[model samples]
Target: MDKQGANMTTNTRIYLRASTDQQNASRAEASLLEFANLHKLNVVHTFIENESGASLERPELFKLIAASKQGDILLCESTDRLTRLSNEAWDTLKQSINEKGIRLVMLDLPTSHINLSNAGDDVTTAIMKAINSMIIDIMAAMARKDYMQRRERAAQGMAKARAEGKLTGRKVNTVTNDKVIKLLKAGTHSWSEIVDLCGVSRAQVAKLAKVVKAEA
Candidate 1:
């Protein structure tokens, strides 16, 4: 919390996340709000996500990043909650923070504090800050490695089940039958566009078109 800017409220975006939808969404927020209050942050908006942090398609997080203004602080409960499951994803998130000119403030690590307003003071504080950032990176990497190991184990289990001739996974929607068939015949667009529209692949489109022709 910068005392000079304390009286004048600044834009702050809050991020709250849970491991899964089954978890209590409010738990993250409750703790984060206390942190925000202690820092006197004027929370302009909040992005709450109920999914694994690895997923690139976090709609709320994307919205928050897009909506964030320069000098706006992104407040989170902890770095681990902010990113897990992939080092690549963590890199992407860090890139977003840098490119967006958004300062990230974590409650747990005070040394990770970023003072965008005070450039002269920053040089003196650089070594300590770097050490704290390194600690965070190491912890985040461990969490991501664990997530990958768990995923690999689950995949192996699925493979074993398949070997035993067990059916798995939800069925594809049958409602796309006519639409997919038509798109295959018409071929109105490129393979990429077809994939976007029909939610199928180049191989499926080619196979379907050939089958249709053979039937005709």
Candidate 2:
């Protein structure tokens, strides 16, 4: 009845990500790796990155997809770890995953674990796929909703603070910002390289670069 026997090696790629560089991207790595070992899944690669879940510009995530083939599991700690993208972006991501025939497995989504093994009958597998897809889609939608809600709440808080004369806006970290500006002024490194070096956004570097050029 079970197609994937004891000796069947499942190629699983574990992805760990965080929204910002300050957060440890590998925070979930140990647990996910332990899960893989417990499940006997063969982990062929591990991709980690410090990137926002709001955007689909994560290089490591796309790289993992490119490296995977049909039946290969794209494993992550949770649905939110995979995405907190808006509906359109999430649809795009889902399209890519489906088109590539990659299996999505989340540690929190037990339903998706069914796809990890080839042990079920066709009917059972079909049922599991339907259930898993439905559950994951719901989770993705909720994640997106949560992200939007948090952003809305932040905006509201900012507005309230402004009205109360309590908001001075974000204070520029002169130490970091000046360092980034100096790097840009040096004209020696690329924006991305500067971003990595200074732990600041590309837009921040570009803004500082424009100011420096204007002052010159």
Query: Best candidate, TM-score-wise?
Result: 2
Q: Model 1: which ten-residue window has the lowest total lDDT?
A: 1-10
124: Cα error in model 2, Å: 2.0
Give lDDT tens digits, candidate 1, residues 1-216: 222345544577888777655566457776777777776667777788775666554677778888876677787777766777467778888788779877777777676565323344365577765676688788778767776777799879977987796956756455665667776556576757777887777777666555444320
The CA root-mean-square deviation of candidate 2, after full C-alpha superposition on the true structure, stands at: 8.5
**Stretches of candidate 2 above 4 Å error?**
1-9, 119-121, 169-216
Q: TM-score for candidate 1, please give it.
A: 0.62
Candidate 2 has what TM-score?
0.75
